[model samples]
Target chain A: MSVSARPEVRPAERAEPAGTAPQPDTWRTRLRRDWPLLVMGLPMVITVTAFWWLPTLGNVIAFQDYNPYSGGIFGSPILGFTNFQLLFSDPQFIRAVTNTLGITAFQLVFYFPVPIALALLLNSIMSPRLRALVQGVVYLPHFFSWVLVVAIFQQMLGGAGLLAQTLRQHGYQGIDVMTNSDTFLLLVTSQTVWKDAGWGSIIFLAALSTIDPNLYEASAVDGAGRWRRMWHITLPGLRPVIVLLLILRLGDALNIGFEQFMLQRYAVGSQVSEVFDTFAYFSGLKTGDLAYGAAAGLFKGLVGLVLIVAANRVAHALGERGVYSKS
Target chain B: MSTTDTVIPAPGRGGPRRGKRGRAPWEEPGSLAGRLGKGGVIAVVLLLVIFPLYAILLTSLSDSRTVNAAGGLVLVPDGISFDAYRQIFSDTVVSRAIMVSTGVTLFGTLFSVALSVLGAYSLSRPGSFLHKPMLFSVLLMFVFFPGIIPTYLLVSSLGMKDTYLSLILPSAISAFNVVVLRAFFMNIPRELLDSARIDGAGEFRILWRIVLPLSKAVTAVVALFYAVGYWNAWFNAMLYIDDSAKWPLALILREYVVNAASLPAGTAGVAGYGHSVPPTLAIKMAIVMVAVLPALLIYPFVQRHFTKGVIIGAIKG
Candidate 1:
């Protein structure tokens, strides 16, 4: 919480011999100074209020028995915590929690280091042109829709697909990697790494750029080899960034891509692939239990918010800059 | 080489430096160990990322006989043909979907970038009335969103359902983009704004005339992001637009690749596998390539800006 310590203007602070301070032109001058900014911001205010803030009021319907056709949000029957109660009692909802947590954990353990490792590798490259070319090739996948990524994987690894066909040609059994429930978590994490590791490395690269050249030079002067210098100097320089990104990842752990899972849910079956976002969507939109779904979404949102705040606090405690400045 | 220039200074730092002459245990030049170690990393990266793309390209180019004969994994096309791409282009639904995707992406990117720039500029001001609250609200949106149901309900209530606006308005300005643009705006010197103000140029004029010209890098990156988001968007289209004809390229791609078992009859080619209209591995690959090509084409031009564009905004928010 970077709360500014600036004091609000007191009447005494502006006092000019008591009576001389009362000038009608002062208000006009202040308005003139600020009016352009206010006017410039008008469209955004209106747009956010109408589209974002007003719709946010609809979150209250989570506490009501929301009937879209019968009555509007205001007219809906009050149902207290019944929606939340329903969500808690459901087994599938519990599974969604476990599945989401599982995915996040897997990503943290496996997917998180990929970008850092890639950044290190790219940093080690002596040729700038080759580094840029490799980066271009790698980062291209990040912009692709999950649909295309999944489709590519399926074309290569799905049953009766390229990898399977290759296996048959080699007189080996086909690998069932895409559809198998047991391997879905690994599959998702690997796919995420493939798509994002290069793009994610940008931050680490930025952080790497800020590292003092003197440290490496000093290490070289001390007869330290490449591995020794990298382990001590380079890794230490990257620590703050790693912590910052880790905290950010912790914050977004719950939002492990809705469309990615939803598109492949039918193929892999919801029993394995179901996550909090998709669960909320299906229950709230498809099933017409609006309040129930809203409760689920709200619940996830609250947990995510808490996680982010807590992570930020922890980072601050660890003496790092954290996600934001704590002035 | 620099590696061997200064190696005999000290021994307390670590083991002997791996100069050009003194190769380390890991750097066994011309040895099986070095080749295997370096080769493994390169091979894994290539197999994981490049091979799928290669498989898709080869499959899309190959004839049906070559495809089936090779068991859908042809490193090289036996004989090249553009039949799959030709077939996709001829299909009215897919062609219309492509047009819809293009229109949405173009309009959405323009509107989003304009709004984001304006909003970000205003928010970047030091003492604007709504600055703090607006900034906080935007950050809050990043964590506790109104989620899918409420957003869908809001979209439907606004009567944006099944319309192009449904694809654009609800997501016209992303909070992340706004934050990024605001950060970029903040980096502009306050003296510039003051000078513009003295010259009788309004905020919008200053933003347009000065700020924008200087912000070409970030603006291009953000616009490309918005365009890609619009192009690849399927969730909003899936939820809001009920009409199959209004589907975007991604949704169509999703149907083809994921829901392969449910593809319509009579669409199956002569080399169909069974009653399922078994989407030839080639068609899936073709659709995947089609979906990916737009971003790939636009990315290189904006690649240089990505580091600055993503980092500055991300850090601030």
Candidate 2:
């Protein structure tokens, strides 16, 4: 409930007077003073710069006629928006964009409330032991690889799976939800809920913990029933957290689990399951169209950045602490 | 089961009945109605979470003959056998894949954690020349940047194709881990660093000697995350590694579970070891279990650390 006990500020550390500027010192002395932290930071700086940042710069190939074998990213001739033009011309790329947006929208609407519901249900339980057991069980799926999760689902619900097999044994038709395109969206959303809902509830539970116990006591005294109290107090208390999480989810809407979709792509025949990342992976890497793939990826990244910033702005406007302090 | 029965509990009232001497309505003792309601909730939760695991485990343990003959649900194996596991382990290909997976996970975690800790500690400091920009870049990496294709091209063009580095380097330092470690490092008193400085302790020395020891919980958590990420990593392996021998256990498991018809000869050695039993659906399940077993084993030890790590990582990042 308290998040944590207020971090203790030892007296010796507090000895420095407030509102006083640090003493001017020699550059050597200043370097010596900050050197430990700086040195500690060097490995990360070098690693990220070389691996993440430099490779990121390679995305510039999107604007060039880059051929991996013939010339490197820097050596490639500039082609302006040719890659974008190529991407626009591809019907598959258009389908990818549409599918990605559709999946993102589905997850946002259908999958968003699951964690909240789970948290509330878990919160309602009085037995800590039972609550914990349930929590652990539900969270186990999150650790599983998307491949395993999909396989598990297929083994249980596919046409030849346990459920369908049982139906056939009883002289009924076997339902094939796994490879059915019409049910693909529902299938993916359900899988997402199964895999992440419990883990997602951790934040909501943290929010629940912050609700004042005395408020519940007062509500009880007023004879407000469980449903009414949930409506008035619990939901309102969770408003900030829900809004914050929603904003975060909005920021990650484009990222809809690449491996999960990719694994099932063959089964569903790509018509229903080709999202942006998988689309890019197949187009760029599989097809050797490096520039085109880079362009698509860069496009997704820009959209994500804009969404995050816009969400943060909206959160700030709504008078809530966003994911980051604007400073 | 019915819509009306799932009445939303009042938030502030806690539940339908409360303060009944350690008995909430959800768990109200001695009342049939209350007991039934509580049992129903527990049953539903259990069904939703536990049943699939049970079903999978049962199917995985069942012999292929029994599985085929049953023609439907096999809640319990007719006879339990270790043939599946034996088949997977005995096979040279599967064994080699496991070795590759283990190697990647071990090296990847070591490199990632080492880099992340150092970076985080540096970033945690109050001021440094490149601090703001570095921090912003790291955060930006978390939110957006070059997509997977560009990253794949980068790896491929750098001549890392079909090499172990493809798996390790691409995701070496997670931005989330950096943020978590930074939060933990910042929590360390500056006075400690000052005193260490006064005592002629070098920055690296202080970090290794003092900061790391105090930050065990977070370090362990971050290490676990890195390890799990590496262990479960298959996308990179699928994309970059063209050679079958270089496939990690997860990638192999993917082949086993998704494309079981083409059970590679690698898993056949273990099958031979287990009394000439062929790798079947059970073995595929065993491979899945093997792939997931390490994380499951490591998680309980670091469970407490995980919650703390996430809170710190989320709020700080």
Candidate 3:
């Protein structure tokens, strides 16, 4: 799941005032002057248009009874909204939607604050060496592939895993947490925490370090205790960052890491594991129900676009830049 | 993370009166129960992160006898051996996958960084030809996902299926990376470029000799991001590459490790080690190590640049 961080372009006033600049160049003149720069940008433009934009345009297949063999997107007969109707009625699609939303909401509540708390804990450590060591150990997992993470968890918690073996040795029944559908939510949440919580804390820690040390000193002189200082000063300092990240997370509610669920689908079964991306992969690519799958994907994408635009407005209402600024 | 480094007071600033480590005078030391509780939490967090790594490393290195003695994943190393690594390397599937992953990461990162640097530089100059429209096109991607089916259909229709180009081309230019690079580029003093322009230094020359040398940290961080993405990627391979022989390490890793499939029968013949083979668990853990070691090795060097890189895109964005 990728959260798009949109950098607002800074004003160009530093170079020259637009009002005071020379007369506007003709299109030909500008083209002649800027051809070299445009040449630099050509490869990216072609690549993105071909790979990103063209595919985006191809989402119109959702409106057709698309059959590549008989007719491509243009030649296929259009049956607008029929695929969407079929998608909504399909129980599997509904389950996928429910599971995706459920997981997103669950993580928002349970997994979101972890990094904030971790940053706080790390900030409290007086020894820089110990802090660095802990940071290094925790951040290592963020770089590991999802497959490796799932494999590690399996060795530790699967039916024939370390935990199970240790339990059997003690005359207790072995537990297979990895394959337990009932606790799949908790299992995935824990895995996500283990993998990403440390890396997520980097931003919060940066925000924390930017907080003036003088605030804590001044608060202490006023007889504020640690908890009070944390509540009154530290949390306030982290508020802007916390709000900004929270908005981004809200915008990304539909996007979860697809590989994690894809890997575990067989273990826990798709009833609990299927998500929108996995659903699209199975229904569209796996089964060649291109129209139906595209409809499902387009529905999700449209909703995501609307949600993000709405969320950005909320960010601006709160006087933050959000992902994209006015520029 | 680099931001935390500045939190430490310089000795000269503090007049050497304050020691390297101590609670400040206004702060009360934690009570015994509290300190122990905090220490216990830290220890648990550390163990949670470290134990799995330590277990896998030990298990991968353990001999079959030691692995059998431990029942499952060997937590403690009784005997160390390279038998598992030897078996894994000897397997053509794994060796080929490693080479594939390495090649993809190297070529993909270079291609991506070069594209981003070019695009970012092109757009960094405001009032240049078509800057607004071009930037809008790039930023539009942040809000709109092209959806999977269309992308898959497009790739296959273009006859890129079962090819390495399918892996790298789709994700070659991340808009965020381009924007971040552009943001860094825009910060360069205009006078520097103007002086170069007066001396007849072309835009490329200014970018090469001036901008890049000054922006090494962000560039390295961006390159690291792309390299890691290329290394860890499997979904694209799964979607596009129907040929299992062309599978990268990550895809093979998923099939072998997560799925817990037995190695192909000829894997032993390929290794030429019919006797004294390590347990399958050791081989699995060894594969995990192989997949992870590059990331672990490369991370420390770029760790310090993370906060700087992240902040530029995040807070500024």
Candidate 4:
């Protein structure tokens, strides 16, 4: 069961009883009571207005033939869905879409279970100190930037890196794991695992530790082997977290990240490396085609929104606490 | 289990007894072979994770002469040289970048914490005006990320381009951090607040005297999260800052280490330093270390609070 941390606030319940609610004096008293709280909220209100709301309003350009020469949103000519139509018609955009989904799918297949495996392995070790040390070591790479991670992989396995040098010394051929277009999926996914698997296991380990010890003890007394105990008790205990994270992951299927690809795109060539974020950056920001780029972004945002909401509903239907409760 | 079952407990009773080496009480005492096997797995995973660190350190320290001899990456440490650490510290470009990064992280974290703490506090009270709308707005940002182009346009148009504020403000407050902080704030017992209110304590007084002090652990965790974020930021610099001299350490490290490119001219000492400089390999690895090392040093201290606070606040909040 999830521990409730948020004050389950219901705005409707907080409203005053209907009828006989019209007085300047009443609002004044309410304002007097709430003005201090509102002061605390001032920075957030300003920030959200400037950053979130304004940028959201800037999405208007996506529907317009926006020009830098023109004064932004108001001055731009309307071109409803024209930019989106052009975006979809481009072969490069199609390539980006395919690459995005392809890499995301590969990560889901290969990288998703890594943390679960890690958490289970870690839980099996009875020594708390050992578990902590291993955890510290493995969780470390998560803090490293994607640039550093890609660099680390290149340093170890690139054409002129340690493995390649050692192979050359032993009279073998060069290694090109870092720059090879064919193995891009494997290399990137491994980097993802190396960077995130340990960190991801934190929640799973938290979940694992929460399982009642008596369950394990009872199962063991019932003549279950270690593997059988794990399959029956441990696995069941982790199901909620697994489902929760899976739903979240499905929601984020489009966000495969950008830095790794951007850093490596030169080495592997853009042919195999272009994803939506990079494509958006290249097409919009770098080339000064804000409207077209915004269209691509808007499309991605729409899909992501639908995906997350649907995924949350599915999680609720399956009796899992996905991200938020429906209330 | 390894105590030879000498206590001779009744059937169900023995399942909860002490076992050797702190094995689970219900576990069959692992055989010597089994323990060794477990240790071996841990060892291998540790080696795999740590091997890159060793390689980078060794390469950074290896005497410039022996580095090429030892195959691109220095596999073994031989006659450790401080040339790399010395060079980057001495170099103007890298050192300035380090200063820039420190400034951004310190200021950025402070700004982020202030905004998030205030916002979270404002949203924590259930019946406050605009509480639900504000909270839902924040939550909606998570589902529908503002597109990169529009965000860039907004920041640029607002005259944040090339400014340090650009580094700090565009991504100033994280939704996750806000949610976590709000969760922590909300968890403060309602009765405690009510009692404080009855004692004539205003919301601000209660927040400062009671809430802030009580929530130190979560506060530190959120602060560190923002600090690390600011330190690791390069994409913002790439997008907003045009002046090469304004580049932060992460951006510099990205250029020198990841892209394997030399710093552009006018950056610092690199342009004028003709020939006698140390090996580029050592310099690159040293930058990598510089980028990564601070987090390592600071991690252990914040780790306890970080794990506990983030798990409870983030997942549950």
Candidate 5:
């Protein structure tokens, strides 16, 4: 995604004389002038209102004793904090939250820096052809669906998989890492790294490209070693982007992805694999407890909002522009 | 070294301090040990990325006997046959799923791109009527998500539970893509748009003639993103679609390749209506290949635009 672009508001028709600003158009005049544009924007407005805003507002059902046939969202009896009270007391719900946060924190430490390290490695490659080849190969897995990635991992790591089959052939006991719930966190983390780490490196690679070649040359001419130059020049140049992405990651910490966990939940059992999204699905939708599940989801959303705001505040405290500016 | 061997030698040692293989003059080629270490790491990374894909491709093309000899997935290609491919192509479930996926991706991409373009262009101009609320709504979507159960209820309530529209509409509009498109449209020289307006062109005509032509790269990139999202989506199908006949290729891939592998004797149920035997290992690999092949085929064409497209959306958003 494009970074560091300020909104360039150069309204074509409104580029009047600098000193003398024209009077703002009357509402009637502006509406007459811009109706076609309004018409053009109507579909998106309706869509966002219907699918996004409406569903978000539908979270009111979280507080109600919601039943589809017996008094839907509007007709359901209000239960105040009853649904939430039940949610916090449920062991499965607590487990889902714990597993979700635990995975997010684990990935932040292990998976976050992988792409940065990869970008540095890629940047040091002297041959453009080799670098391009490596980039293309690494980026391929990112495009594969979660289902396909899971299947590939299964073929390599599961019982009767290549690893196990080869071991059995060699007269050793076979291993099945895919179904081991104890190491499910590590398994999912590795899968994520395999799938996304290379693609994630694109942003850092872009940041690296922006660093001037002259700085490297100047440092090298001063007799600085490669590692020293990286420490002094390269990493400092990457700091802003690094900080920016770190803040974004913190903001998005709650969402550890859905399809990945959902696909593996049955295999590993939901105890280890049930994150917030799957928890909501299984408990609320699958079990037909509409309000209770919605309560769980709403709670997650509100916490996410708090996390993002807090992360943005931290960014500002660190003197870097976070997601949104002070304005 | 090769250039020097060709006799186009430097005038003097002081002329230009060129290093080997077009390395910059100030750059060090590093010690032999360090070079080997870096080379080894790079080799492993490439192998980690490529080996799985290579094995999957080979196994899909191998005969049942060859796959059986390998015990699971074939790494070394001893023989090649298209029996697995033929088997999948003839299976109604797979063929129908492929058709469903293709239709959804095509229609979904078109619907998303059309709406996004119109929406982005309408909001491209600053100080337009109702622009603030519209833009605010789009931007707000980035921060807050309408949780899953609510979204599910909406779909069911709308009578779109079993329909393909459920797959497309819920995720049809991405705020980041709209922002990217809007950014690109705004970057287009106002002179072009103003000149067209001066020449009696309406806003639509101007957008069609001036803005769209200039913003084709961003639009194509946005369309690619939407198409890929539609193609790879399975969770939505799993949630909203209960009718097995309408399941997309991704869901089918998940069922036959992923979930089936974990089930005890799972392949027993995968054979065609009257067939007795389970699908071979070759057929499972083939299913995985079918899911992946489109992404591979389309990568080279769209690969170049990703940096421009994504970086724009990321920074702007």
Candidate 6:
């Protein structure tokens, strides 16, 4: 959030060079220099304020004993800490916390390394044409709407799905993980792997291509085997990219997905499917408890903020610029 | 050099003669076994991605019986028919959804891109009026996410319920898009903009004539990103617009195609899968195809801009 800035030249004026440029000795001069840019920014200011900043203020409802029958925020009884207290006391909220953490952890472990592996493999391919073809096919899923992804999955593995029916024709009972709520976690995680891993590998692939190829040649001349060369040179080259994406992932860890869970919530039931986002939506709409939902959402947002800062600090400690630098 | 570990006979290997047929120093893993291993992994991944997509196309075009037999996906393409697509288009509910989605994507992308361009151009120059605060505010959004409940309440309270504005206005600007566009804008030579200023050209004129002309690639990329975003977004529609008729194609796909239990009541009789020419699954697959089609078409054209997009996006937060 830190800003390093130089003054902009207003269109109305002929601006001089940086060293000799006019600095406003008075507020009027500053205003004269600045107002046009402000005018240009007006639409965006309203857009951000109304959509993001204003709604952020609505989180104050979390501290109220909110009832929709009453007027909004001020009209509701002010119950300090009660809504949050109720949220923590509820068993459903606890399950949602677990589900959110569980999904994020599963993705961090199983889904995180997939892109790196794909990038390495892509980098190793001998023929450029074949490599491009593979890259094309793999990244296609990244653009799909999650609903479409869920639909395709359902069509594939639901009880009446293609494979399931094929198995039935052979007199074998078919497996339908789409309907099997017990394995829903694994199914969803695999969907994430299928949908995103290849697309995610792009940054790493770009990073890999930028590595000085002569280093590998030099290492080979030193009689270092392919394995040793990879571990020493290639991995080190990919480290900065990997760390950047990893830090970004930590900031987004709690986002352990909403649309996927929302689409599939009916199949597995809310208990298993409810993450922080779906929890907010379901409680607010389905349960008719806006205040409680806001409380849960606020709690998640605050925790996410804290975790991102902490993760960035750790990344800084590890010598990678995490997202952005303090300077 | 080290045991010649690979069975691969490097086609371009420079034997003892370094000058005659010297290989680039960087090329490695020229082993036959290694090549086979890498090829095998890539082939499997290719299938993993392609298989379902192939099945979807086949299922959408397959005659109803084959589609039914396979449950919903076809193993082979045969007796291809456009009946599913025809049926979907003929149905007003689905057709309207498509229209709504198209309208939203077009209008939303246009408005969003316009706003983002103006904002990015203004912010690209450092120390622009309120630049620090504006940029800092956007960066903070990455941390302090406004939640769904609050957002939903705000929109509903604003009387935007069931209106298309709810879908478009809330997502009018993406900070990432602004940052990327700003990066591109700033990369335009300062001397060029300065010369424009010296020529008595106004800020807007310079942006439109000089700056924008040079930034066509990034502008196209950012525009496509917004279009794709507006097209794919259904969550806002779901939360704000309860009228199914006003639903975007993505939401309709979610409801009728994906959610078997919640298909529109009039379309199906007792079976719920709807006994029809293009079977339920075929129609569902058709819906999925239509939902994914525009992106599939546009992505390859803009694919070259992706590396630039991602790198520029990363340059900020």
Please name the candidate that would achieve the greatest TM-score relative to the true structure.
3
User: Using Cα atoms with residue i matched to residue i, what is each candidate's TM-score against the true structure?
Assistant: 0.87, 0.88, 0.92, 0.90, 0.91, 0.90
- What is the C-alpha lDDT profile of model 5 across A217-263, one tens digit per residue? 99899999889999998999899878878887888888898999999
Query: What is the C-alpha local distance difference test score of each model?
Result: 0.74, 0.74, 0.83, 0.79, 0.81, 0.77
* Candidate 2 regions with alpha-carbon error over 4 angstroms: A1-28, B1-35, B265-279, B307-317
Q: Which stretches of candidate 1 lie over 4 Å from their true place?
A: A1-31, B1-36, B261-279, B307-317
Which predicted model would earn the best DockQ? 3
What's the lDDT for candidate 4?
Answer: 0.79
- The fraction of correct interface contacts reproduced by each prediction comes to 0.41, 0.42, 0.59, 0.47, 0.56, 0.51
lDDT of 6 by residue, B1-317 (tens): 00100011112222232112234554453679876877788889999888888888888888677876665578876687988888788778888899999999999999999988988787776645576777766656656787888888889889999999999999998877776777678778887877777577777888899989998888898898789889999898988888877999988988887776445555521244454566777777888889989999998888766644333243221
- Candidate 6: the clashing residue pairs are B8-B32
Error of 4 at B231 (Å): 0.6
Q: Which lDDT tens digits does candidate 1 get at residues B15-54? A: 3322313333443244587547765775576567777778
* Pairs of colliding residues, candidate 5: A1-B310, A1-B311, A1-B312, A1-B314, A2-B311, A2-B312, A2-B313, A2-B315, A3-B315
Clashing pairs in 1: none
DockQ of candidates 1 onward, in order?
Answer: 0.27, 0.32, 0.45, 0.32, 0.33, 0.33
Instruction: Indicate the TM-score of model 6.
Output: 0.90
lDDT (Cα, tens digit) per residue for candidate 3, span B1-317 = 00111111111333221112666777898999999999999999999988988999999999888988988888877978998899889889899999999999999999999999999899887777887777777777778888899999999998999999999999998888887788778778977877677666777898999999998988998898899989999899999998988999999888888887766877832334555878888888899999999998899998767644333343211
Q: Which residue segments of model 6 deviate by more than 4 Å?
A: A1-25, B1-29, B68-71, B261-276, B308-317
Cα lDDT of candidate 5 equals: 0.81
Residue-wise lDDT of candidate 3 within A1-327, one digit each (tens)? 011121121122224333443445667556767888999998988888899899999999999989998989889999988999999999999999999999999999999999999989988887877887888888778888888889889989999888999999899999999999999999999999999998888878767777777788898999999999999999999998799789878887888888999999999999999999899889998888998889988988998899888878888799875778775
Query: What proportion of true contacts does candidate 4 retain?
Result: 0.47
Q: In model 4, what is the error at residue A239, expressed in angstroms?
A: 1.1
Q: Which 10 consecutive positions of candidate 6 chain B have the poorest summed lDDT?
A: B1-10
Q: TM-score for chain A of every candidate model? A: 0.89, 0.91, 0.92, 0.90, 0.91, 0.91
